[model samples]
Target: MTEQDVREVLNGRRAQAARNDGAILDAARTVFLAEPDAPIGAVARAAGVGISALYRRYPSKEALLATLCLDGLRQFVTIAESAREVPDPWEAFVEFLRGIVDADVHSLTVHLAGRFTPTPEHRDLAVRAGALAAEILHRAQQAGVVRNDVEITDLPMIYEQLAAIRLGDATRLRELRRRYLDVHLAGLRTAATSYGAMTGSAPTRAEAGARWNRTT
Candidate 1:
């Protein structure tokens, strides 16, 4: 083949491969969200691509899952980073928590993060997101908007408890989460200090995982 012809052919192949990769990742996200243990073949079918093509893009199901998890982590980091821009610290903190729960309600990655050991990249991204969340929490506490006793770690458990409720209807579930979220937000305020003694200890990661897994 002529040099120009060969270059054109290579470019076309690269474009096609990129498209296939995108489709496979999109399909994997949808399939895994519905069933975390879904097979590679199901993802291939969902993506409308051949199994060989999917395998070419992602050698294994785990690899595909890692990509999905990484993407979700990036999105979470974005939300937390954006929260920092809000003028009010308390509002920023509340919105950050809201973003996490809303994303968790729609995507499986956040839930998976709780269930499985994170990859190094996933862990790093999560830590970055957590740092941003911690900053927001600290700002709120310093402002005396949020209760002094509340720790950053408490936020995840609150989200977990709120997300654990599953109404069969989508509309009802959305409303329920929103209503309970408002209640939880209100309780987090400093003025809501009428409650009795608080527990000093929080659940370990393993304990939290076990509790959530039981509910699932």
Candidate 2:
């Protein structure tokens, strides 16, 4: 009933409002990505809020949609880390390569994937991913399991082709890409004269490089 109590009540309301708005943003993304034309009620249901409450904050469904797409890319980057678990460096590289292929053709680089520019934070994450691949490739090469001529930075382009070919023909694409990777890896494993034979003994810990444990 007092002035101080009234102020506290208003402040609490404002805080709750902000939290509701944030929840709407998150829920909007999930709803639309799950089904772009999903009803407003669906968004409310997904958000654990009411339909009226959703509209009260975002007047237009379009506004809510735009927010969803804008936020989707960050989530994509977060999901891309699932490919980093393979232990062998060459296989680890393949895991990342295949992941990019799926991402480009199916999600992150696809139409509804949203235009998430590479921010410094995102770019740094990308750098870490690439560095991890390179380290793995280096180790694989040292183990005589991969080609020595391969460059660590060439991974991105390899993935692009893999995705494109896969989209065009899934079976042939996998065969060709796998063959190319095997041959490329073979070359990197040994000298041109030796034809990159797998002459090394059991893989040494040092030759495996740092184990990839991508933070999701």
Clashes by residue pair, model 1: none
Q: Assess the local accuracy of residue 44 in candidate 2 as a C-alpha lDDT between 0 and 100.
A: 82
When summed lDDT is taken over every stretch of 10 residues in candidate 2, the lowest stretch is 207-216
Per-model C-alpha lDDT, please?
0.77, 0.56
Please provide the root mean square deviation of candidate 2 (C-alpha atoms, Å). Answer: 11.9
TM-score of each candidate? 0.78, 0.41
Which number leads on lDDT? 1
Weakest 10 consecutive residues, lDDT, candidate 1? 207-216
Give the per-residue lDDT of model 2 (tens digit) for 75-171: 4344345544567765665565555554443332222323323345544555565556666667667777666656654554455444444333646
lDDT of 1 at 106: 29
- For candidate 1, lDDT tens digit of each residue in 1-216? 999999999999999999988898888877877777678899999999999998887888767767777887788788888888898988898888788777663255344544444577866886797788889999999999998888777787787787777776877877788789999899899988778445676666565435323222
Model 1: lDDT equals 0.77
TM-score of 2: 0.41
